[model samples]
Target: MIKCIPMIIKGVVQDFDNNACKEINLDSGNKIKLSLLTEDSVLRSLNSKEKVDLNLNQIVNFLYTVGQRWKNEEYNRRRTYIRELKKYLGYSDEMARLEANWIAMLLCSKSALYDIVNYDLGSIHVLDEWLPRGDCYVKAQAKGVSIHLLAGNVPLSGVTSILRAILTKNECIIKTSSSDPFTATALASSFIDVNAEHPITKSMSVMYWPHNEDMTLPQRIMNHADIVIAWGGEEAIKWAAKHSPPHADVLKFGPKKSLSIIEEPEDMEEAAMGVAHDICFYDQQACFSTQDVYYIGEHLPLFLSELEKQLDRYAKILPKGLKNFDEKAAFSLTEREGIFAGYDVKKGDNQAWLMIISPTNSSGNQPLSRSVYIHQVSDINEVLPFVNKNSTQTVSIYPWEASLKYRDKLAMSGAERIVESGMNNIFRVGGAHDSLSPLQYLVRFTSHERPFHYTTKDVAVEIEQTRYLEEDKFLVFVP
Candidate 1:
């Protein structure tokens, strides 16, 4: 914990001041100094990494400490943090607390076990026996697990990775996002307070540094860690991969693209309003948030109008980025004024929204700001080809029942998650983003295919469903 303090500090700097995060206003947007001993600075010092080294005992202690802290006062501390965070980020206190409580629940819950086992939709049941794999088992012991949490600007995506490591009883060294620095640190502080002697407390580290800062710190830490968990965009993932040691197991969580396929909208007002939440949630910063919507029916023009009216309401809440507004204006001027067809495509007060409607060849364009490329299609099938590789993460359907009829076709379109909810926030946040979850990435799962069975003749029977079933159990009873 001591050795990695600087790393957490560095990350806090970037989380608070990420070019995108800093552009928005939160709590007067006061700039704080967030820096660490640079790579050069570390080289100048003697035994820089020595302070963070830990034996097995300390690692176990840290995990216990984390459990105690979370078990005691996580909710209260998190509520306080949420209030401050809302003020800092300029978000609604209600919304912030809701999201914060969700994060806290995820951090403290034992749900990672379910997230890993229930890979598919199924009822929960208990298994009485132990399963083992080659050099790994159902209860695999991890020694030094270094978790590099690549935070998304979205609410709790980053914390999932950290929670996963903790559940596995790994000595977690979390690299939290620079955009939201203190969430993880505060959680860790809570643990340190509960039982300072716990190995998990001594084992945990939360800090931040710029991607360009001393790569050696993370590299060394990664080399020491048995597993490395990372979450972020392509650039962040690429950097983490480069810095991670060759022998370390890399569990990557990268940014994903999502979309909405609407069947019909009564009018433009309705379509616009429904799609507005997808764009405005966390300012459309979530990886699963939709950047494009393709309406599959002749009702689109009316849908667009209804969408516009509803969007106008949201414009009062969240706003668009300055750069995003300028770019759209430039495109509209040069491409002829009628491109939007008299549609009001401009920045609103409070940077609440930026609605852009233009004729696009397809929905393949990368999403930016609070923008969604509204594409009109004659059939939902016609839009299938437009889903690029990144569509593996999200596709929310309007009136999900009708969409399920063509579900097979939609799955072929490469979407991992489909729901009736038109808004992205309706999608469960703790699950995997592109076919992988935190537990799937943070802990290794290996299975043994060998079968172990005891016939009635081979073992004592516990119960019989009926007389006929009892006859089948006679062999075990005789034995």
Candidate 2:
């Protein structure tokens, strides 16, 4: 008999094998079943009758406590996660362990809550008594509830989605990705172990169902939330946007194409190593991962040769775990296309690594298994046309100084971020993402404006009638 996975409802995990279960066999030789959510539980959350008034500080403290537990070798949370990865996901020991450690460190940061206050409410409002205007008071509150449709690319994404919701004091109902079914479950277990009665624990519900045309279930989930944050590629984002009710707001972090612009200085080999790390890390699945590299100098042969050498080094150190049939099929198709298109192709044994040198200009053709497209350009301006506002995300430039020199231009050209060549995968916690501070969007800022003596008001400081409206979300701060 196959071991059955439990379906989570309102923080309760129970056996759910009545009838509406969908069985799926993971690429890693594990068979799993997904059960439907309890209908009443879904409806009750939508109604919002049970208001959860949890203090944000306590929630942060609880997360800090959870992070501290990582030090306890016997009580480590990563052991279970690592087992899950090996059983059903494609993460190797190195990748799985790194994710667990990084997520623990991220949970320890106290700045996430501060960003909500500093970015949403003015920095002056961090202290209850310290006033931004000496008389006016302001506090950022939750938008009632948020439902997140998380992606399966990285295990830490589930933790990230929930952290933002809880920090803003919003109740959440998380829908985990099919590719990574055990990530949220492990974290939820941590929360329950610490304190089951904590309001933070009670306010969250982690559930999953097979992706299908069941509008009834998703509609109920979306209708009940004040906002929906959909983190996925184009297809997933479109699905959520279509199913969500018109009144509910949705934040779409859709598929984006990122690239590395390298100015080959004297140390050409060192430059290649930097670009190689960006390609190998995360298997090129992350939004910030560079899919294409634009080399701006002579000695193309030496750069490509060094890049191949670094890739071989990574293959031994940070090796890939497994690939599903779809990924394999994609590799085959891309290799054939590159060859037929008359592009110079360089690959390893059995398609382990493939490089298409000077491939034709295109977007969304990435094979995504350490397979990269390299382009040689006489001038950097050649890349400007491909920076489409609809899809560009990060532009990692060499030497760190190029990022500063080209930051404003890249921003204006529609790229949201410009990081150092080797640091594309790293983003500071509580920092702006996709050009907006995440906490700013997760909250609803409420102002306690003191009445100005009707006599005199400085026009410069007077409240502006118009504020920026983000689709259905209005982030208004009287200036």
Candidate 3:
């Protein structure tokens, strides 16, 4: 008899090669290998399933067990598990540890514990005060739901969606991302170690399958689930949405990009240098990390030149990943065209960085290839339109002063959140998921009771009347 638990838990565990321990190249030169169980593997897992029964009471017990175990094991003590994982995956110990720590934090924040307590206790202190408490469906009476999570690449994203489902008191069916299934599997085991009978455990199911057109598996999962929460590109979101029943609520986190603004120069040199790091960190893989920069001032061109110089200094210190090659190639292509402006773009064929001038034209030309893509703009206003068109998530204002003055305008422009230059990647990333760091997005909520309604004022229409009514009660209209 094949045990479902161990069979379902298999993953890539290879010998650590010294060369493979280097930083991962985002490009992989198209040599990327799928790490998780492919789509076929997923279907096969389901096909062999003799029984797919979940008992909520038992799952909840498991949740408690896992949550407690995670809380007991401090981050430092848990480092070894991820260190082993890095060795297995042939990645540098540093990168693996960082990614693992991030995932752990995402799974159980200090705040997450508070959130779980508040949820089980059935409190509605915060939810009552907020507007659009995030798209609710599935009547209050629904119980024991299944959540199908489609994870994204930027580190620790799975935590947000998984926690939300738990907080909502629904069982989860998490489909791990091909790029990162091991982390999720590790998380599940952590729960079992803490408490084998944690109630929440019985309610959750984590699996990975190739993307399939046939709705058989999804339909089965959906049939049992009262809610479906998915995170991915627009196409993945749409697929999940199409399969979801009207009764099931769908929270889809989709494609988004972010930029930063450099308004004034208390210290132009230092500020520009700091902004450059935001672009380059994590090899520019994060959505919130700076991709484009808007500089405002008379000597803006000089400022961009100064930024290029600073970027060069940092480039040597940071590890060269795969994306560096593509960025270098792109810089060369732009230079040949002669459209690049600012400090001399110096990344050669073998170099690991690309620094280009911000195009003066609004052709959406990005100078940095992988980690950073900076552009200097004459007016700060020009950047707003770009943000609106592409949907920027975070806009880090250089000087602290601009935070107050320009916040409303930035919000009006459609940015979901704002942050200081240094804090871009510190916050969690996903859909509408922002930095302040609440565990609400992670685990299950014990009690979520908030009323919702739209008043006439909420949907008011203002009209400038041409004429006032005289004898009659109604106003007269003029053509």
Output the lDDT of residue 154, model 1: 63
lDDT of 1 by residue, 1-479 (tens): 11122333211212232231212222335333333434443232222221223332343355444444444445566656666466454456555655665664554444443444344212112121234533233433343556565673764665556655654456666666656665677666666566554445555666555676556655555566667777778888887788777777777767777778788644444455557777666666787777777777776667766666666676555443234345455434533443435543544444444455554462222335566667777776676776656545677777666567766887777777776534566536445556655444443433444333323333444434365365775454455
Judge candidate 1 against the unseen true structure and give its global Cα lDDT, from 0 to 1.
0.55
Return the clash pairs for model 2, or none.
none
Question: What Cα-based lDDT does every candidate model obtain?
Answer: 0.55, 0.73, 0.53
Give candidate 2's error at residue 225 in angstroms.
0.4
Query: On a 0 to 1 TM-score scale, where does candidate 2 land against the true structure?
Result: 0.88
> By the lDDT metric, which is better: model 1 or model 3?
1
Candidate 3 lDDT by residue in tens digits, 214-296: 55654665555556667677777887888777876666566667777887677877777777777766656566767767777
**Ordered list by TM-score, greatest first:** 2, 1, 3
What lDDT tens digits, residue by residue, belong to model 2 across residues 1-479? Answer: 55456655555665666576667787877787766666765664565433456555666788788776654545656787776786678788878777777777767776755554565455624332334454566666677778888898866766777887777777778888877778887777777777777777777777776557566776777777787888888888988898777867788788887999887657777788888888888888888888899888887888888888988877877777688888989988888888887788898766667888864375336788988899888776887877778688888888677778777777888998787877877775445678766666666666677653322233333343343343432333322
Error of 1 at 112 (Å): 7.6
The estimated TM-scores of all candidates read: 0.69, 0.88, 0.66
